[model samples]
Target: MTRTTVTARPAEPSVVARLSALDRWLAVWILLAMALGLGLGRAVPGLNDVLAKVEIGGISLPIAVGLLIMMYPVLAKVRYDRLDAVTSDKKLLVSSLVINWLVGPAVMFALAWLFLPDLPEYRTGLIIVGLARCIAMVIIWNDLACGDREAAAVLVALNSVFQVLAFGLLGWFYLDLLPGRLGLGDGQHLDVPMAKIALNVVVFLGIPLIAGFLTRRIGERRMGRDAYEAKFLPRIGPWALHGLLFTIVVLFALQGKTITSQPLDVARIALPLLVYFALMWFGTFALGKVIGLAYDRTATLAFTAAGNNFELAIAVAIATFGVTSGQALSGVVGPLIEVPVLVGLVYVSLAWRRKFAVRGRA
Candidate 1:
């Protein structure tokens, strides 16, 4: 006789259905959050200052908590158990890892230097954004595009691990050492310490990955996989969304004065970003097709490569650079540009799916 597992029953309108709609409406919420954050910052006067004052290691305590909350739920949902399975598709995995870690950063670096050569601060900020790959929102984008969700989860987990290991060293090379050698406008001399990078990884990625893995394993063991995926996952899913909204509010609140004062500055920061997103998405999509990857695998690679982990980038900007620094400002502007742009890409992906209609596994 075979042992059977008990699972949660679905409601007439399941939690997944309700939450699924949230991703579609995320841009609206993000805009609203930005407005509310900016409004509160402008109206309250000292509120942002007060928030900035409560800090340790140059990181605001409240913002740190919000960032962690934003990250953990997303990381937890990544099918780490399925990570090895992704390796079976070596071409897809290798292409994604190489593009995300290498080509992505190089493009952003050149674009920043090309577009904002005179503005070192914004240049550095853009480079930092480029270095940080997507960990959360790509999941939504992947779902919207009807890509391989399992593949997306596996790539996300891999990127998260790689970022923790490479971000600091990359930052040093691109923003600091390489610039001096190449003579890119005094090299910016940005001081991004490996220790700081390592600390952030431990705090933002490590804690969450460990916690997520433990919780998932224990939950599945106690309640069974079906129940855990259905009941438990949905329950915790909203944490990332809520935390994201709260974080956007806090970020804009902190920079409301500067943002309102220098509107063109925001545009300058956004310029390279828009180009970066388009290039990454289309480049990867075309490459996927050229390599004869299936629609699902191609979509997965495109979305994964296109998205940026702005939450981690923002936190790092504030901590490593200063709350009021241009680096921090660029980080703040990332989501403002990213949400609308990526949402647009979702539609484009849908259209492409209809147009080409190619099919093959990576």
Candidate 2:
């Protein structure tokens, strides 16, 4: 008894402590990138015009490249063989579909009208943002938050399908039919061609998805699952963040003047977006927990529901309305608000995970 020795359990690392340097300072880096982009756009006279000219099938080439880079690594990390498990979860699938397709757009519609009643152009643009579900960048956010990769991939693919089929119809309903029925506007119709939406889905989601699938298949075949996951994934992981930063820089640079010049308008546009993101993220997360989803799938559901396809929204805005239009400006203001907000949500998701773990142990 006198010689008895006791071992104390080591304390778990805090969430912030566990993060890599890059992930830890994501907000600071994003803010810096935004500042740099804005400064460059303001300082360099012809930069926006130059950047604007580089387009592939009506999408900005630089932005497209950045998205592809950002998407590939996370997509590659998915265990494609296990996607069947994700698909078979009808509750998760149905819940995501309802939240994304039905509730999400409805909430944005109410918020846009509530917040920006006087500004029809901004209102319409926000409605358009609502219609475009997250397909590309939500994956990055999901990965960062340690959500189920396969579930995200499935949900993204599902949204992409709905995007091609329903985006135009939803656009008409929100922009044309609903407003007219409600006597909100002068019955301005927004015709978002299905072909354009289809093309975007192909380019943005399809290409990278195929690339990621093939990369995983080939890497696993060549290197075995252990090596592929342990060795190969680490090398490519950082590029996702790199691509995110690069996209932000280019995006802010393109809209720097507009963003800087129209501070009041930006603030106005930002308010509804802030409200919408908070509602969707927290509400969906709560819903997920209520439905008995584990933290991983719950996090996946929340992120996919919360994030918007700003890429498509911006492209649709610019293509339908002039690049200089309020619609396009509203679209530009989207990612500006979304980036930091969602990044903050990533930490929130992590904290919630820790809390749940502690409760389980108790």
Candidate 3:
């Protein structure tokens, strides 16, 4: 088994290789969005004033756009009928669901409480974020993780279905630990805002999801697997990135004032997030392996378990804690570090693939 570290990768990939490596650097794009937002927000607070308010009944358009963009590729990948083919791979489906919804959230809560006792609201925010589950990016992470993509698709569908039914319940249940400040502003029930959140999901996760599924089925029915995958799925990746970028820009712009006001708190929030990421990545990865999943499925479990929707986190934060509270702050913090952190993890997953493959083969 080739148990190599990511450092063993060439100090630089070739230009063509680097061109091919665009997805690997999604973190850089997200960071650049952060910088652009900071510049715009600081230079013209009016810019934030204008951009932040492109809202409807209170929901932000950019976030809606992001939701559509995030789910399109995911829904595109979903093959309602493909399960007939991969039903043989039940282990992948079962492990992904267990790790993603159950184990992942629990690990996040533990990590948050243990490492971030000083920031209770944000710590609880982490728990809230974890409970939100995966939407679109899990596909990118699974692809990067070299996971069984079909299995990942199935799980995404399952997650979207389950999140809506359970979001309100989980939101109220998880954040029940933290007291609400209804007199000061925030809502009494964290999940109550999910009615708005559910509309966003239907607009975001539901519409594109249905469209993507239809498109995938038609494309596959007409052009067959190789052509559809080669033609459509790859294109969807860029769209997803653009959507995420748009979301990232607006997020940083809206949150820039908060981030700047108490800059040192960035470290305090980020530290526990770092700890959270490590715990999640390894914990899920190890759990998958111990349960006897292979390299690909194991990687998917690891990534899905580690990634959070943050959409729900942000929404609930606004509803429960207002835009500037520590909880809301932590919700925004999830994305700032998410792409970069997960990119590092993709490499780790790839590096460890050989060793895990050997074990699987054994």
Index of the highest-TM-score prediction: 2
lDDT, each prediction: 0.76, 0.89, 0.70
In model 3, the worst 10-residue window by lDDT is 1-10
lDDT of 2 by residue, 90-208 (tens): 88899999999999999999999999999989988888899899998899999888788888999999999999999988888888888889988665677778888998999889999
Q: Model 3, residue 337: what's the lDDT?
A: 75
Roughly what TM-score does model 2 have, to 2 decimal places?
A: 0.95
Taking all chains together, each candidate's TM-score versus the true structure is 0.81, 0.95, 0.81
Error of 3 at 297 (Å): 1.6
Q: What is the overall TM-score of model 1 with all chains considered together?
A: 0.81
Q: Compare candidates 1 and 2 on TM-score and give the better one.
A: 2
**Candidate 2 lDDT (Cα, 0 to 1):** 0.89
- Give lDDT tens digits, candidate 3, residues 13-41: 32224445556566577678889876666
Candidate 3, which segments miss by more than 4 Å at Cα?
1-21, 77-80, 85-90, 177-194, 221-226, 231-237, 357-362
In candidate 2 the C-alpha lDDT for residue 188 amounts to 60
